[model samples]
Target: MSHADPDQLTLVALGEPAADRSTSDHVRGCAACRAELASLREVVALGRESHVELDLPMPSEAVWDRITAEVDRKNTTVVAVPPHRPRRRVRGLLAVAAAAAVIGAASAVVVDRAATSTPVAAEQLLARAQLSRLGTAPGGARGTVRVVRTGDHAVMRVAVDGMPAPQGLYQVWLYDGVDTMIPLGVLTGGEVEVPVPAKVDLTRFKVVDVSAQRLGQQEHGVSVLRGELG
Candidate 1:
């Protein structure tokens, strides 16, 4: 009858086992706990779905080992110090704490940068298009596409909604304003990134097309979503 612990509910939402039967029963019966669990699940799903791979710099093992050794030495020295030198001991402890904090902050900075570096670099928007429904698609599906040129590579991010599942798979294509219709990649729905070839000229291939392609089809399929990159 009691409410579930927030920590236990979080763990359960994250696919971890609940702490106890009481927590499990509370989560099942309590509307508030169920809502919180659903919200946490959505957040976890978004985190997993929106993950972008980034090129991150790794700290060397020797650097970590040295930090560990230094901390160990400081701890040992602190403990061995006599009570007569209380002021000196306090100063030493404070210095060690400060060093640890600095190291932790630096490590956190590196990790945060590595996680967010890709999106920042890829945010140089080159072109954008509002994808409109084409042909006799059942739903009033709408989407937006953004093309970004990061360094030598170009990336296209697409977000679509109200799209009913196709018979086969949805594939993205790029047209080079001529006879060439280059296939970028397959789309899984919601939001997806399609990598454009670095050598491909975006000026020529300005058309972004999302098509429903049948299995084993080598040619360009029916265009469901169409947009022109400006």
Candidate 2:
């Protein structure tokens, strides 16, 4: 009936099996959703490409041991890597090969400024907000927001936990807590990077709100979480 769920489309694109069977069927029949899926796949491809185009040598085993120890530590959430099992390949190999051509007694490095640029300097954190659960939100709902300046643009990097899947999609917004509410973008899953509206003044629309909205529904729906920007 309605277009495939955005979150499910992202999961499918990321090599994780679909959570709902209807989403797959809808994607097969709906050209719009299929195109959206393709676009998400491109983003994932670019992330993998960035990792691939690194001109560096593999780190020693001891170096990897240190990384593992950090991951084992508590109270740390690793956002750099996607949680999907199959996508681990991309996260596992970062600057560990791909763009490097090793030779005897010398390391030949070839950095593609074009390919690896997105994941480097473009990711600059501007602000952060710790989202608080709303009255309508689930009991264990929690979210984190990071306003990251990506190259010329700024985006809201939102990550949530214990959030139930919405009937349609979850959308991020900058609410002024009065009249104006600017829609950023559709949130694909537990985490998404939504492009903030251009020329937005955070002083006005300083509240980051995540809402569960139905397909093609105008105006806001049930509020899941909200956080004030600092």
Candidate 3:
């Protein structure tokens, strides 16, 4: 109410009242909370409108090996390998999962940008702002969607911060001008990576949208955050 709980924010977005009377009362009267709820609702709506489906090619086995190796290198600093008496398997597993989540999250930000606009090299062209401000951090949850082009394909990445992870997995979507939407993929924790489907023309789509999706209702696309591809 006075302060927003991401959980309560979610319930409010779904048009549900909080179970706690005080929280419910606060949400009803708090302008800031209400505005946050509205934004969340809009994102949900955007997800519903997209009808694009991703059929991305997986990285080759050799590529995967390299990726895993890098993952290992990044992970080593986060987790320590223990000596004989006490194995650090649990720590190791958690470290790997965290690294994967970060990678997946960062990759999602990349994909969100690519999906939104016509193919363009990744650059910030704010009317009066410098690009340096846009990327002060490598990948915080609070990143704007960006479109980056590579060879024959475009990638989109949306980085969002503050909101808690969904109960299940978060997903990403692509929306063309005519009310069609596509389910790019499950966001691994904080990021969602979606390759533009081969059948779709990158030049045609103009918006990249991101969302926190619920299971079993795949087609009810709505955007949680969005940016126009330049």
Candidate 4:
């Protein structure tokens, strides 16, 4: 007997009636048709079992605004390249290689911007402070801090000048009026924006501190620059 058509086997695997008696008889007797039907049935069953429904929560307006702004910035910088015409073999290969290089560079720039772009929108300035020298910091070491509240969270934008590069890294911290000091994030010299956790109350953790930290040392490190939110 001849093997059954794939369509007929699919129907039989799905428990639907086959097209005719010949296809049905072929499916019953042919080992190939039976194996194919079994595989199709297993796939169908797995697909049905794996289907899931979920209600995803939407990001806040501030988050959306930041995303829109970054997208706009990227779109503004993008240069549209027109399609090139076909040429001689050697020239065509060179043109393709040049085009690939240009595309790769453009992709790198976009990815860099996306990674470095600030996540929070700087809508309202909550507080400003001039960072004063602390601990073993040089007399010339000075910085400026600006705290902005965007949507449900706040961010501290810090600019440090006249300070020598540290041995390890510069870390930003928020200090409550009491003894509690919360590490916000790491700073990358010049100007760096550090995100404040939503659970942290800005009113309570009003002090902004920049610390010179060693690689493995965790606790507070050594405060190099200190400033109050007000």
Kindly report which residue stretches of model 4 are placed more than 4 angstroms away from their true locations once superposed. Answer: 1-122
Error of 2 at 201 (Å): 1.0
Ten consecutive residues with minimal summed lDDT in candidate 2? 96-105
lDDT of each: 0.68, 0.69, 0.51, 0.68
Can you write out model 2's per-residue Cα lDDT over 1-230, one digit (the tens) per residue?
A: 56765545644665657766887888888999888778666555654453334333445564355345433434555323223322233333333222221221122133545455665554787788999999988899999998978778888889999998888999898999998888888888699987876789877888999999999988987788999987
lDDT digits (tens) for residues 47-133 of candidate 4: 333232212233344434433443344466532222222222212222233333355566888999999997865589888889999
lDDT of 3 by residue, 72-176 (tens): 664554322222211122223223333454556668878998898687555433211001112222343353555555666655555556446665455666668
Q: What is the TM-score of each candidate against the true structure?
A: 0.49, 0.49, 0.35, 0.46
For model 4, the run of ten residues with the poorest summed lDDT? 81-90
Clashing pairs in 4: none
- Residues 56-164 of candidate 1: C-alpha lDDT, one tens digit per residue: 2332444344335545763654222222322223223333333454556668889999888875454588899998899756567988999887877779999888888
Q: After superposition, how far is residue 155 of candidate 3 from its true place, in Å?
A: 2.7
Backbone clashes for every candidate come to: 0, 0, 45, 0
